[model samples]
Target: MSEKKNTNHGPQKGGPMGGFGAPVEKAKDFKGTIKKLLSYFKPNLVKVILVFVMAICSTIFSIAGPKIMGKATTKLYEGVYGKIALAKLNTQKVSLEKIASMSKTPNPKVSGGLAAIKAGIAKVISETGGKIDFTYIGHILLMVIGLYLVSALFTFVQQYVMAGIAQNIVYDMREDLSTKLNKLPLKYYDSKTHGEILSRVTNDMDNISTTLQQSLTQLVSSVVTILGVIIMMLTISPILTLVAIVTLPICGIATSGFAKKSQKYFAGQQKAIGELNGHVEEIYTGHNIVRVFGREQESIEKFEKINDELYEVGWKAQFISGIVMPVMNFINNVGYVVICVVGGMFVIKKKIEIGDIQAFIQYSKQFTMPIVQTANIANILQSTVASAERVFELLEEVEEIAEDKQPKVIELPKGEVKFEHVKFGYKENVTLIEDMNLEAKPGQTVAIVGPTGAGKTTLVNLLMRFYEINDGRITVDGVDTREMTRADLRGMFGMVLQDTWLFNGTIRDNIAYGRDNATEEDIINAAKAAHADHFIRTLPEGYDTILNEEASNISQGQKQLLTIARAILANPRILILDEATSSVDTRTEIFIQKAMGNLMKGRTSFVIAHRLSTIRDADVILVMRNGSVIEQGNHDELMKKNGFYADLYNSQFSDGEDVG
Candidate 1:
């Protein structure tokens, strides 16, 4: 276990064992999954069939060579050596034949019956012109050559097909997962950890891909090869075949027992990784706070704890899985020894030839191989199923918000916005907006002012359809917001929030994000209007300057201004300014306010601000308290009422030190 101390602040390392939660205690969905997994090979069915055919051919040829050689041993022993021992019989046959023959003298050795039989066999051989017949040898060589070629060809084809299928399935899974993520609401992220989901999509999927490609293919080949070998062994000597089959139960018990320990440890390893990633993400994201609060050592201590725990889990899992291979191999070797001892006895008793014994030894290896392959395949199967369950868990996430079934398009002629007795909350039964009613006619600027958690931003979120209203209706141009497509409803407004989210792209690209096909002129004009063009031009690459993630290279004020420029480029009928000037200096705020003035012309706008001065010119100001409106009016109207809004205004604007 590596000490969890902050190890140079690099990304937490978990190469193969990165995922979340414990491994399953029992196999789930195995039957359905196997069917689905095999379906991927359906397209390559022809190639798979060819591979099986070639495997059988190779196995049969490999078995036949020794069988033929064993038969040849018996024939040679009887014909060559057996005949040499019959000298007396041959001498008697030769004397008889010589006395009987009148035309020519016969060899006295060939006179006897046994000698005559040997002479006749020798004459037949001699008639072939001393050319030894090698047809059987030629046939065996041809079979060997065919087996070699077919095995090589099929090996390539099967590997290629498996790799292709695995990659394709991985691609499809990634795409589907990504689409699901995009569709899920923002609330889903609020409850889940990013590291956990990232582990599933990347590490888990990769495990499945690698396992399916290698283990699955080898599994198929091993099964078919073992079956062919067993058939040959049975035909030759069923007793030896039975001896081979006895090794399987021992292997099954050994591997299955090891697998239980391996899975437990492996699952623990995955959980430890998720925790490590989550802690690392938190520390890095809050690095500044950790340093400011002087908690570096505390953070290091926590981090080291996770790292050390991961090491322990990893070692245990690897140790258990490692034991399986050697144990199975030992069992296989023992089986071979038993077969050898028994088969050698048979050979001495003349029950089987030496070649047959040799062939049986090879068959024993084939028989044990399938069991080994099955164990390995089972290991991979366990891992892939764990991964699949994670993937399915994500896919099964409850949808946060539903889309309109028959969404109506937003119309240009009617842009009236209204919140008619609307009620909402982030969580159920906890209302953030309760029976709230407000209206912003076309070309009117409505501002909302309140303290933190007073539901100001929550109201804006409802208008933007980021969350659903708990009660009452939100309408645009007299059409209920829920009846319109989220896209069309959102298209009616341009928003600039406090947290400026910028992708890695050029300055020109960020500004044009709202209007996809926005022209260069439109971008430049929008930037100029938002007072972002001067800073953008000062950059080394001018408008072409690319931004890193979240536009980290720029100042906070610069990012806000860029986001504002994006909204301006959108040219929406309604503008939403959410703390647009909060992170900027007074000078930048003045520039942003001026830009807002230009953008708000002829468009209904909603401004949610902590800075009280920004809302002084608003046509109407709404003060909220505890999910309901407390006061409503323009600045003067609210000031005269002398309630919460009046007190807020006095505190923010009292000695004329500009509120931000």
Candidate 2:
């Protein structure tokens, strides 16, 4: 397995940052969305509250720190402007004094007044250096530093809290989604692509996590910062603050305008991704078949086409979204220019002080900073919302069969099974099993035989309640099956499918899968009974050998036997053997058949057989044709009837293969 590296920059490796190309798609009902998102954090309300408070504090400090820096700049400039003003006044005084003294009869009044004013001006210039009160500059610097430190502390707290919340939310959502999947009606899977479903659970949820981790955090901080900055701006200069407010409309229009284009591309990208995943999944599972059929180039072409579509969507989305950040940055800079140029005139005219103008310039950024943050978070926001919708859609899917109003505990009495006038289909207005009826007594092995697509498997499906009957009912031990809980109903039967799916675990784990608490002795006995112990013993690791992905290390025949052993361990009251021996060779088939006979000794068994020789001794033979039972009786009775069953049996025997 390859290690997962951060691939945020690459197209194929979609990290949290990948979906920036897509803009926020217009989703109706913002209020409802907010409510739904909030519900995810309901359990951690205290943490959420604390995080919000911290965001507010952080915003206050962030806004205050910059304004304080501006204030210090303003103070320095005002002191220079004041000194220049005082020097000019003193120069005027000296010239007036010189003019008075030059008069033939010296005007003492003019001279004295000029001399006094000059003395005052000289004293002012001298005292400016000593007691000029520029020490406030140091205080302002400290204030800026203090605000920054406080903001940083609050930001740290907010980050840690929000991260914890986001992780917890993702964990809970995945666990809930998994549980819901297990409870979903089987037919939901039949009509849906596994890739699409997987995307919702994995990719979509991951998008939500990424959004929470970064964009959501920034969004909160931005709002708080904006609010705090606005308050400070209002306090500093109300008139200049009005000029700062104009930038908002421009930013909003720009963001919303670009977002529209981005969203369209994003939706397209998601669709393309789903299609790509579907194709990839199909190709991988059918790689061997593709090789046998020599369609490697064809598969590659299909993949390339899908990949190209994704690229187009991705490019368009990214291109549109990319403009937002730069554009917002530009607008923010323009807003700063406007504040500086316009506010400068006010300060020069003495309508506002230099400090007020400087503070207003910084506050303008505070006003536009939210817009910048929003632009940055836009991609994540869009993807997260889109992913959330998909996940909710899956959660809202209707189940195949509704649970009983009051389900009863199932108590099996001898394991007699009956299907009476049962009907089922994958969709409405179509029936796979119509008025089908069958009965199996305890310890009786009933074999159902038919050509492919004759609904032999459908019969087993109905018994398992994979689909609900449209017409009649199935019963276990004379009680209506629907009355029992689905889990309890399924617990009565053990099944071995044609295709066995194994998880990554040991051979012992696979065998014990049928019974959660199955003992070591039970596992070994089951394996021995299924005729799998001999082969298992010869293996280097025996029962301890681990399996990976469909038990690929083992042969198909071995997997089938392991399944059989699993069924034997479950020791269900009823059993379903669907092509149980199909994968095995002739030598293994005979031994497996004998082992199956032993397992079926005291269980009600339903066997769907392809080879006639395997079911020759079955108590009852059911011959089906196109979803209808054409003939049914004991093996001997069916042969005597000389109907579909008899013809099939004769054809099999006439072949070169001998049936002893």
Candidate 3:
């Protein structure tokens, strides 16, 4: 056999940055992603509208406060103007008569205005015994305070409502994707790494949650503020409004140019993040192998490369979006300068009030502020849409070819099984298994012995429906397996693989996973039959001993025994042992073999073994090579023939070392 390189565990080879560098896509379908995202919020339609109202009311109230405050400024200025005697040089208490005589230009209006002011002051002094009337100013300040208070209340309500809505949508989306996972075909998961799938479920969902609550509401409020400010500015002076309008084109050019350039980078960032996650997950899960091979530094280097790529793209995307503010600030300064100059002229010409100019300046700031925000929000929307597109893409993946419209159920299954003219390949147009045929009679041990890459595991995968065969039929008890529900068909068989899989749970809980409703007595009996009861009793917590995250607390041999115990407890009608004793020590192999022997009694059993000594007693032996069964017979019969099986069996002991 040709030896392959040992570079499989690291980042993919022969690509930019060792394949960690992400590809760039042009014109991502943000519109479609956004439309699909809206559907998720449909269930909260009424609450969404209420949230919108809250935002609008909050913003409107706050927007109106500035105009009202401008009134207060106008009143205060006019009151001071009325009281001042600009021309009077000296006086004991300059009465209206002395000030009138001293003023040359103000004499015409001073008498009437001073009489009105004196009469108002006297009226207030008569009512409350005060020389000055502060009641009007107090009322205006109080009104402005009330408007702001209401605005604060609306803002609070908006956040509360939107938070619940966004979270619920997130929950529902996660729930849906999780449910879809169980229904998806084994091939779907086989093609995707755990980290890639997890990235979509966790990171993408969080993005949607944040953008839905913050960006969505920001978009709405900014839009409303822009429109309302425009109207207010126009009311003050259309000429100044035109001056502010000039900034729109500059903003459009900058935002559009940046958005188009940076949007792809943002999308690439999310994808790279997923790729980085996949790399981390793969390495961490196999950290033991990395240490054994002393490849820690190599792993770290690959990690740094991916991390650097992620940072590079992420920085560019964020920096490009960040430009919007400074660009708008420049635009806003120019726009405000023009509006201020024009409004100042209007005020001097007496065409607009000083109060109106003050309000318009505030309005102009308010208007451009939203324009800046809207542009910023637009860039955020691009990233958000990119994340949403990934989520929707997962949701759109073709689920396991749907179950039959009317799937049959095997109420009872016999152990007899057959595979006829089977054909399969992992990829299109590349055939792996062809014209395959096999059978296992009830109560017979069928041992499949094969060279490496001889398609033994692929055959088992096909039988279990992990992957559908390209052509041909698989049958159990003379009934086509496809006709029966996959769950019902699979429940009839138990599998103990070369790699032991025990989740984090108590010793009892992990064993009980095979048969959840099993009584304690049944569990103990199965453990005893597997010869695993002694170890269970020796543990500190006995059968209830809890396993750590990776079940690393126990020995590999012990874990294998527990799995054997589980299969025994399941009491399946058909048994499959795929190198089941591969992990166990020599002494423990005796117990595991005895247990497997008992479990296989009176059941159809298929033993896939590399050790010829282990399966010498099989009722039938099939020698396989290059995806086809080449020979089949009892051990003695195959040895007499001195064919492929004979040479394979004899080669193991060729050095007189009795290798199995």
Best candidate (score: TM-score): 2
Error of 3 at 291 (Å): 6.4
lDDT: worst 10-residue window of model 2: 1-10
The true-versus-predicted C-alpha distance at residue 142 of model 3, in Å, is: 3.0
State the lDDT of candidate 1 residue by residue for 453-506, as single tens digits.
888887887887777777899888889988887778887788899989899999
* TM-score, every prediction: 0.79, 0.82, 0.81
Instruction: Tell me the deviation in Å of residue 327 in model 2.
Output: 4.3
lDDT scores of the candidates, listed in order: 0.75, 0.79, 0.79
List pairs with backbone clashes in candidate 3: none
Off by over 4 Å in 1: 1-135, 159-183, 189-191, 196-215, 253-268, 303-313, 389-407, 650-657
For model 1, what is the C-alpha lDDT against the true structure? Answer: 0.75
Worst 10 residues of 3 by lDDT: 1-10
